[model samples]
Target chain A: MTPQSPYALALRQTGDVRDRADFLDQWRELLAEAVDRLLQSGVTGGTPCASPHGPKTDVDAQKTAVLILAALHGGSTLSQLAQDPRPLNAALDLALVSFVAAEDNTAARTGTSSSISKLDL
Target chain B: MTTVDSRSGRRLTARGEKTRAKIVAAAADLIYVQGVGATTLDDVLMASGVSKSQLYHHFAGKDELVRAVIDHVGERIIERERDALGHVSTIPGLRRWRDALVQNNALRHGAYGCALGSLASEVSDQDDAARRAVSQLFIEWQGLLAGVLRRLQDGGALPPEASIDQLATGLMGAVQGGYMLAQTARDVTPMATSIDMALAHIESLSTD
Candidate 1:
């Protein structure tokens, strides 16, 4: 069933072990990885927040991924609580807006398209 | 009408009322830290310094006492917060309410999740009565937010076509899910970020 289903969403917070296991299977590592990427980035995309010594990962592409990840779990919880899907829509909108804004800002500043701007999302 | 259970202490003497309140306060604290299933009746008795019979006299069983703890959480934590939500249509008011919630969790050192939401997670599926109580509390909260958003819509601060209930629900999810994320991350920033995103969503809906 889709995460938009009220039952699936509410269960994320208080569901049984199996239900939790299922949710984790789908989104757990993804969120962690995305969050890690966000933590490294300047988030504003101005300073290049990626550390100098850490393994070279694409912080730019991960920006959109992070927004998408945040929207999914955050959207699931909000949709369930409101008993409506509109919040999810708002969240997804916020995600895209965040990424696209970042992309534009980066491209304007550097006079070159940023990695996040290349993403199809 | 659903009968109000006597375990509510409505029929108690002054001294009995004091004892009942004491028990509930103790249970609320323990349950806040330990969770419902982990906290036993003995934990309440020991924590409150009440006798076994006194515990029973005050509550028919653990479930009754748990319901009371839920009420205590509602009164002590949520009601005060709800009053703040009444002004959520305005920008500054929403920030005040959001800051208070995040600060309260930070004060707990980010140990237990939201008192109500944590209790909710433990009992949402395990106990029907308790689950309904938690659900009602959330509804009250969501309603408070919806009330403000509806007012905003009417005032043309927000788009009339925007579904206020859905907006409120999504905001509540941000708060609730942020609590869980902050709890796991052992940092308050996640909660703050979630709330920030939600408020931004409202701004996106605003006509201004």
Candidate 2:
């Protein structure tokens, strides 16, 4: 919420360059780690490494996370334009519902929708 | 005596109004190309070819000029989107609107990106006035999308459990994020992919 929030400042750029770069790098790392953690836990389905010959579960998860993040920031764009958070809230639902629905499908294959309620998300 | 506008009580003349519009459009373009922090009044004057006196007559200061630009850009963006937003109640219509946005971005070749969003992320953090304006523009944008979704729901194209507001927000977010990624990477693929995912969610909601 600071005046220097990355994307808001990325284009306008009233802040230090090194600071902005550092913040962005940190953000990427955080998102990557978060996705990896989720995949490793199987909460998002599939192992973090999955298999050497199989789809790179971590990479796939990170991609999805980034897409979800983009939708979110886009939602914020809409929210800012509208001056209301309702659309942003709707976007959160949009990403999560689709996500949870997919996860439920995977979990259903494993005979356990039980973990769906476990995640605070 | 200073003249007063009947609507907003601002002193202005017909020529002054035209001059102001010209200046605002020039300023918006310049600001879009160069960030507001970097685009000066002199640059605006040079780009717009409007005399310094006229600029001063219409706007008290740089901040005033920037505010005017914000309003001008807001109006212009909404105007451009009006067609797709209105009278849309079918699933195909939603796809058309989404595709049109993607096509518009593609036409730009992923350069400069969204007119409003380009300014939004930059100014949203810069000043209180700019922040408020950006926020209001997004709200307006979301309302337009939500209105169409609501119509679809009423027509039973969307399930009764569907929330128009959320779908609209999610759909808008996808575009916003897509623009950001596409602009930063100088690629249109992300924008297209993001729109697809967003639309896919909407498609999933459709009874048809």
Candidate 3:
């Protein structure tokens, strides 16, 4: 981690920029701030991702980390209140277990790739 | 919602708790990897090493089992955060937390979105119980983050006018969105970029 991780620093510095049309929306700005805060906060628990069936995978922790960050940074159809990143932590527990169970060493690198295929906007 | 029979003092039997835990652990694994819609009671049974009759006894049905898994996930996740955040109250502490996240995500190259979001997208519409369980988890998590934000505020780490509730909500959304974008894009850039931007904006508030 850099002395001042760029994202965390960004989250700490807040402003309502009125001039820029690209980054002026409240929701967008809020998301940026939250991401920054999350980056600074780091992941709370060292809780490893569970992959019930598969051998222990290094991706387990990474999976949990990304999922939680995604929840905090991503948008949802639910109410804004429901959109809080905190849910990411809860979701990470579930994901960790699943990852442990389904550890596919061969396709580990591709997991992210697969997600990208499905997630493209 | 089923009423808890408080008057009757109905509680999970020791056998029931063991059975319930197995089922939840199995379900948590299967649903997250296979997608909730793709997973089945049979899968849960096979993974959990529980018999059909035992599964039914522990849970009224599959929906109930999913709810149980959600609860289990919520408990585990909440415990993890409480432990991590409890370690420190300084800016450096917060940085450690963020470092953990980035390091973890970078490990897998940013694959897989959140389990809760996965369920929310796949099963929320089909299962009322699942929706409620997932929703409850979100509420609890938000409360936890808000508490942390409150601490930051009290320390004057955050601006006096900062809204903890809003900040918590925003943080949650960005994480979710970043995952979605990352999954779709097949790249970690979206996740990394989103977080960086979010952090920059958050720090802006501290300047005041």
Candidate 4:
């Protein structure tokens, strides 16, 4: 996301949100929509676990989306601190591990330079 | 031993040291609650009960004082994590560490988020020095978590092929991300779910 994006601003916000409940609710909805789109793209790439075509897969994708969203929000903060992209990459890699094809997962686990490592998050 | 103030290039006596520590602690608390942008030197002075000259004597300006606050907060967090996760070697130990973190945030209803993380988010773009300080603390924090994962690997719990450092980094992301979401939602469910998902992933890799 761009630095000026609402998500980016929210990620960096440290103030109290007790008075902005409606704003937060809308932000969460927007984030969830974005996550759903990302998961749809991942599914189209033949990642079965994240496919939105089936009921069970839809639930799994929702769960995975939450993890991915968390990683993005959390990882981006760390990435800013270190001025390095590896933390974000590593975080996204792990969050998406469950949906990765079996062979790719093994490749990642064994440190064999999988596509997950190439993610430019 | 005489402690020297790095910014002022002055050696501090015991009383001077105590005064400096009090200022830093107060500033840290203010920054934690109101954020760096909203917090001012005057507020810090009021909260710390130190004169303007005394505050300046210890720090060059607000930026310098902020750096000091970063160090002070980082040290406190690292010390607490060391105590909590020092001997954690099994999945249950890791879960207990997670539980304590979640429970602590629940007390504030996830209002304040992680102390070091909230500071990192606020000052990272504006203050490069403070960013580096916070980055160092995160590295140390990640290292502590990696140590626990390494122990699990060595004990034949986690597979030998697993990368402890990456797993540790992922876990830290989950935590910080969880805290952010939890703070925004004013509920601990998001934080708990985020962390539990990361832990579950690790657990799925367990051989024992």
lDDT of 4 by residue, A1-112 (tens): 3333455466555445664445555555665565566555554244545546642243354455567767877888888788776676667767776456454667445322
- Per-residue lDDT value at A110 in model 1: 21
* lDDT computed for candidate 1: 0.64
| DockQ of candidate model 1 | 0.13
Choose 1 or 3, whichever is better by lDDT. 1
Estimate candidate 3's RMSD in Å. 17.7
Worst 10 residues of 3 chain B by lDDT: B1-10
For residues B1-208, what per-residue lDDT tens digits would candidate 1 score against the true structure?
2323366635677778788889999999999887898899999999999999989887898898899898889876666866787666676677778888889889865657788778766775577787777778877877888887787778787776666665676567667767766665566766777777667656655667
Candidate lDDT scores, in order, read 0.64, 0.66, 0.52, 0.78
Runs in model 2 lying further than 4 Å from the true structure: A1-42, A45-66, A76-89, A102-121, B1-11
Which candidate ranks first by TM-score, i.e. highest?
Answer: 4
In terms of docking quality, model 3 is incorrect
Chain A TM-score, each candidate: 0.39, 0.49, 0.23, 0.51
Cα error, candidate 4, residue B51 (Å): 1.2
How much lDDT does candidate 3 score?
A: 0.52
Kindly give the stretch of ten consecutive residues in candidate 4 chain B with the minimal lDDT sum. Answer: B199-208
* Candidate 3 residue-wise lDDT, B1-208, digit = tens: 2323222336766666666677789899898776776789988888989899888766777777777677777778777777766544555565576566556666666555556656656554577666777777766765766677678778877767665665665555555556555544445555665554344334445634
lDDT of 3 by residue, A1-121 (tens): 1112343223211233232223323334564454344333433121233324332333323333443334332433233224332333323222222232223321221111112112112
Task: Please rank every candidate by TM-score, starting with the best.
Answer: 4, 2, 1, 3
